[model samples]
Target: MNLFSDIRTLVIDNLNAMVAEGALPDGLGFDNVTVEPPRDPLHGDMATNAAMVLAKPSGKKPRDIAEALADKLAQDPRVSTAEVAGPGFLNLRLDTSVWQTLPSAILGAGASYGQSDMGAGKQVNVEYVSANPTGPLHVGHTRGAVFGDALASLLDYAGYDVTREYYINDGGAQVDVLARSVYLRYLEAHGQAVAFEDGTYPGDYLIPVGEALMAEVGDAYVDQPESVWLAEVRSFATDAMMQLIREDLALLGVEMDVFFSEKSLYGTGLIEAAIDSLRDKNLIYRGVLEPPKGKKPEDWEPREQTLFKSTAHGDDVDRPIMKSDGSWTYFAPDIAYHYDKVQRGYDLLIDVFGADHGGYVKRMKAAVSALSDGKTPLDIKLTQLVKLYKNGEPFKMSKRAGTFVTLRDVVDQVGPDVTRFVMLTRKNDAPLDFDFDKVLEQSKDNPVFYVQYANARVNSVLRKAREAGIDVDDATLASVDLSGMTHDTELAVARKLAEWPRLIQIAARTNEPHRVAFYLYELASDLHTLWNRGNDVPELRFLQEGNTAASQAKIALARAVSVVISSGLGILGVTPVEEMR
Candidate 1:
């Protein structure tokens, strides 16, 4: 149960009662009313802006309304004190029993404690890690992959029907370049020395693909013309590269529900259909474009071309859909791809791209808006660069990837759990520094290890209780009498646990999964704070000697923290370790 929501409903009901008693005017909209933790905890447990939001509309003084509302609120058993703060802010102190019941509620819900129905089962298509299928995924792609996968999982927990998708960039000219590069490898496999000249891939990852091609058709395409082998090799090379990409994703626990091929949009009526849909709306036109702002008239090349009126749908300017050579521009296939997504009946679309793709956000949003007539909402998240370091110095690049570090390079060094958690330690748009030495350090400064250590501590508590012959299973602890759990430090941790469900809704609404990692760190801090206090105060310890009831009451709180941490880490796609090694 969400304690914050429960208290908000309590506040609203008291306001309604005040209206009925003629203490305030009728028909005041309570939509703007909010109940949240006070800015200063010294003021109260929770604060509400009910009087301030209702004053102007009701034609009453905020203080007068707050006084009347406070009286009605005081009648509730959950609220212990309702005091009017500066300018009619109502600060509330809840009864100890309210926070005391939270541990039981958390244990009862288990891992589903923070799951929300905020999305209401709306279908959401999340497209991420759509890197070119030319080689294994690099470190840049890993950030998008982790962010998108975690977002999909987060939305699912918030009750959205999420589809994890990857749009393959296999239909572009890059695939032709990949085919030529593999052809050179094929020659090398045939005992011929070859040079990887300009504009060709020389990574050793393609060596096996070249050998496989030779084995499939022995000496058939040997020394053949470009036309004879380009198409066949392009198809084969992309398939092999996609296999490599899939294996790389698996290393990080990511699996897509769909792998959409951009090639399918060509040689078919799909592109024409998408463009025609725009044409029917008068958004397509043949017009001359203006020169760029900084370009001189003499240096400009302006021509009449087929353009999409993207400006009408919030883009900066109209974009050309066809080039002067009469071939589709790069943006044409993208429009068709998103149009196909809209046609699939998804209510929402989310694209995760590297920071380099920030310029494409507005145009892609405009395309989806025009295609769906503003019926579908699209959100594009750009993951910024990750700077790698070891021992406080820049890390070395992967020899296998040729130019950059591969996803496997990071995962192999720290395992998937550390890599995933550290990637999300910063906001998606903010640059992240992934320090190898610091992340693995078993200290409070390392959030991943600190959070994992909290869970491990809870497990240790349960094991010790079980060995002491005290029943510490979830059901038994959930039913334990927690009236003795009224200490200030114990209640502090409970207050953090109560914020879980609310935090889930906020993060899901804003499409920010990084907030989950942030919340877990705070919760872990609260837990560790209480755990440390036990050393000084004998009764504060979770395992009370010779008293089963008291020990169960205290251990229940530790178990509750573990439950919430597990739930949060599950959304982040990180497995919570039972014990930190």
Candidate 2:
């Protein structure tokens, strides 16, 4: 159970009683009332703004209302003291029993302790790692892949129906370029000299695709014209590149529920249908955009074009949907893609994009808004760059990727768990520095190691207890009497455990999975603090010698920490280490 929510309910019940007794006004809005941990722990265990928020509304002094509210709250068995702080704030100190019993509650819930129904089962489409199918995924796409996959898992934990999706950028001229590059490789496989001129991929990764093409049709397309091989090779090369990308993602433990092809939108009526839907709403028009700011009039010429009135939906300006050559502009297919998402009946849409695509955020949001008529909410999260370092110096690029570090390069060096956790150590919008030497260090400064160490320590405690002939299973520990757990340090760790459910709701509402990583670190810190304190105070140790009763109660708390850590790491797509090697 959520202790914070339980206490908030207690606060509201007392307020309603005060209103019934005519001590407060009949109708004071309780929506603004909130109960949270006090800013300074020295003040109290929890603080509420019930008195302060209702004072002006009820036309009564805050202190007068606080005093009456305090009397009502103090009568409850859970609250030990309810005192009025500065101006009308009410600070509460819960009974020691409240904190002592939290371990039992945590054990009872197990890994589902922090799972929330905040989303109420709404369908959410999360599109991420939609990198061009031109080559294997690079380091930048790795961050987006981790962030998006973790977000989908987080939303799932928060009770949202999540769909992990990847949009393939295979319809553009880039595929044609890939085909030509593979043709050069094919020529090389046929023992012919070839040069990769401008606008063609020169990476050795495509050499295999060229060799495979020669093996598939031996000497058939040798010295053939462009028309004879362009379409066939484009399709073949796109599949190969996609396969490489999928393998790279698999290396990092990411799997997508759908792989949407942008090519499907072409040679079909889907694009026209999406544009016509907007046309029916008077959002499509033939107009000429004004010259961009800072451009001299003599340096530009106006050209009338088919445009979408994106300004009506929140874009900075109207955007062209068709070029002067009468072909669809880049933004048209994007609109069609989003329109298809809206028609799929999803309640929410979330796109994880690279930081370079920040400018596309507003236009994409505008498109979804116009398509869904502002019904379906869309949130675009932009993942920033990751700077790699080795021994405090900048790391070199991957030879396989040619110009950038591949996802497999990072995963192979540090393994998937370290790579995923380090990627999420920073906020998505903030730049992250991944230091190879520092992340693997087994010290408190290394959050991943510290957190994993805490879990490992819990496993050690369980093993010791079991060897000592003390029953430490969840059912037995949950039922153990915890009245002796009155040490200040012991109670502090329990207090942190009580915050898990509340933190889950906050992180889910804000769509920030990084907060989960941060909370796990804090929880791990509290656990380590208590574990170290036991050395000075022998009686505070989890395995109490010759006392099976006391040992089970103490070990219960330690095991509860592992349960929460496992749940948190699971959401981050990192397997919890039972024993850190």
Candidate 3:
């Protein structure tokens, strides 16, 4: 199904044959041999670097090896022709049947066409959207949430046993601040004036929590001291905040398999266990006497602290696990969390963090590395900021969130499909610009609409066919004679369809869901180009008057393109609209 990978195998087979014939050495390493789509479509269906990579090792010229490899490759029924081009690269043109067969494969596979086993069932723990449970998820958290959810889905499709997780920050001092804030709301609920102090949350979100607290306890804690009410209110307030975070995530169709509480690590001896595991490995130490590189001499001070030997695993410096006050640092529980994931017997770990947490990546990786003894690999992806715009001007704030734009604010206005697709229009590490006007615009410049339009156009064709009493279902068209689709423009679209499985693996392996967005756009472009061509060339149209046979084949190709688009969009959590309305 993967044409590029198949062709690479073909190239390797021919190289082995050449070695048997004594034209090349038997032991030449073929690891670097690669077959891929050439930069330009005009070059060939596929291109291989077999000659160049093996020339020096084989003690033979690249052009000489390429010519021999070309002849053997041409013997395969799938490869129609092979030619040696500049620098002895082999370009191959696959037979028309290869392109024609793709539509049938797509129809038969349906939505599972691009699903791959690239991860090989590796247990991958993807911890993401671990935002503080202080408030509802905002636009900043939305990007990470969407990116993480789509990643878990993508890895699942790629055959990874993925666990979508959220780490709650309830054990921190912030929760105490939240409790005090909600206590103010409780006092106000009792008809007493309350002023939010400097460290208390002032958002209206906590107002309801205050009222709920009053309803639950009546007047019991009306004038209670901080010790009598802080713990109870903090627990209640944290749970309520977590509920709000869950609702915000649900708005974007995100579901987590686990909601890990950082507070659990404190009383469970898990933090001590994780730190002790590192201590046993000689990674824990009471050290750290150097000042920061650029710190002023007056400001710099030497302080001995409990540290993890993160430098042993490539961190810039050792990381502190505990302060002089003996309380665990923020990074302490994080280590325990990942250690718990490692002990869960996962083969891989992936963390989806905000760009602000880029500094934590190295130490986290170091922790996972030491915990798993390098048996498990950890991949950390940082999602950058998403700048919002409206009518070409920067959108500054959200009324509901009281600070940043809430996730619901974006989803409510644009729906989940647009929000998901537009969020993945750029690389995760790169800044994304969410233009409210452009995403909804029904123009080629808007990728989301363009892709949906392609699917809608396919439906339009099927609607017309069904209305004309023609069988337009996939089963009927899949078995139709596709000889009429031999035109250059028609076959070009099929070529793009052939790349779906290969593209999926690449995107999934790189953990880059944005690649699916790019592929969908390109596939949509090819589809639209073919559709536009029908206006000028009457015979290229999908509707063939009085010729159902030819119409079925052509329509099959069009439908197959839409199927791939829908499948790709599904991977990115996008929905294909039936119509532009």
Candidate 4:
């Protein structure tokens, strides 16, 4: 079903045949041979770099190999023409029938047409939006959440067993700060005036948590000392914050398969075990870290502490696992978390972090590398910041979160589908602008609307065709004789359809979900362009009066386009609108 892979196989097979014919050297590696869309469409439907890659290795001129290969490829029925282009690149133009047959192939596969086995059932754990469990998620966390969810779905579609995970950062001192914040609110609820210290949370979101705490204990801890209430309140406040976090994620239609508690790593021998694994490899040591480059933090006093030789595994510097105060550092809990992931038998680990967490990427990768002894690879994807705007001006922050917009603020403004799609309009590592006015605008400028419009328009075609006494259901249209779809515009849509399987493999292999968004936009654009062309050429219209046969063929093409759009949107966690509202 993968047309590109199919062409690659053909190229490889012919290379073997060339070996048998003694036209090329024996046992030449074909791994370098790749069949991809030409950089310029006018070059050909596809191009290969086989001759160029093999020229130096075979001690033969690339043009000579390309010329011979072109002659042999032209003999294949699917290959209409083949020519050796500049520098031994071979460009191929496929037969019209080859493109025409793609719609039927897509119909046969339904939504599973572009599914790939590249992942080969590898187990992948994706951790994302693991923001501190002290407040609701914000726009920064939203980008990471959407990116991670889409990536997990992409890997799943590519045949990897993926587990969505959220690391609750509940064991840190920040949760203690949250407890104090909630206690202040609790005092406020009991009609006692309280002031928020600079380090304590001052968001109104904690007001509800305070009220609930007051309701639960009924002033039992109202006048108690810090030792008696701090522990109990800290645990209660963390659970409340996590509840808020979960609700925020749900607003964006995200659900995690695992919620790992950072506290679980403590008092469970997990942290010691993770450090012990590194110690066995002589990676753990006690040493004073060098003064950080440039402006170091004010607390940068050089003190000997337990450290991990992270530099050995490709970090900027060795990282500390325990502070000088005999307590595990923040990095210590993280190491244990990933070590647990390694112990869970996952073949791969992926962490989708906020752009601000870019500093942690190298150290985390180093930890996973050391813990797994380079056997398992960890990929850390940092989603760049998302800037919010409305009415062409930078959107201001929510008073509740104080300095940033919360995730729910976005979902409530535009539904989750809009939020998720707009967040992915750019590369994960590139900054994005989420404008409420722009994204919700009913124009081509909004990708979600354009893609959904294409699907809805396809459904309209089906409705009109069926009303005209033509059976337009998938089962009926798929059986229609689609050979009449020979116009260049009609065939162009089919050509895009042919790229579906190939596009999936590329995006999946690169682990880039943004490619899927780009592909869907291009596919929708092609369909829309064809529609605009039909406005002038009545014969090209999808529906023809008293000509159900031709209409069915055109409608079948539209249905195939819808199939690809819907499948791509499914990967993006967006529902394809069946009818435009």
Q: Say which candidate scores most in lDDT.
A: 1
**TM-score between candidate 2 and the true structure:** 0.97
- For model 1, the local distance difference test gives 0.93
List ranges where model 1 is wrong by over 4 Å.
22-26
Total colliding residue pairs, candidate 3: 0
- Pairs of residues at least 3 apart in sequence or in different chains that clash in candidate 2: none
The global C-alpha lDDT for each of the candidates, from Candidate 1 onward, is: 0.93, 0.93, 0.89, 0.90
lDDT of 4 by residue, 1-581 (tens): 89999999999989889889988888789888999989999999999999999899888999999999999999999999999998899999999888777887788788998999989999999999999988889999998999999999999999999999999988988888988899999989999999898999998899999999999998988878889899999999999988999889988889999999999999999999999999999999989988888856785777888999999999999998887679998999999999999999999999998888889999999999999989898998989989899888988888988667999889989999999898889999998988899898889988989989999999999888777788877777767787777888888898888888788877877778989999999899999988889999988899988888888888888999999999999999999998988
The parts of candidate 3 lying over 4 Å away from their true place are none
Q: lDDT (0-100) at residue 152 of candidate 1?
A: 96
What does candidate 1's lDDT look like per residue over 501-525, in tens digits?
9999889999999999999999999
Query: In lDDT terms, how accurate is model 3?
Result: 0.89
lDDT of 3 by residue, 1-581 (tens): 66777788888888898899998997899889988889988999899989999999888999999999999999999999999999899999999988888898788788888888888988888888999978788888999998998888888988899999999998899999989989999999999998877977888888899999999998888889999999999999999999999888888889999999999999899999999999999999998557888899899888899999998987888999998999999999999998999999998888999999999999988999998888889999999999999988988677655677888889888999899889989999999999999888989999989889999999999999999889988888778877556888889999998888888888888899888889889988999999899999988898988988878888999999988887887778877787767
> How much is 414 displaced in model 1, in angstroms?
0.2
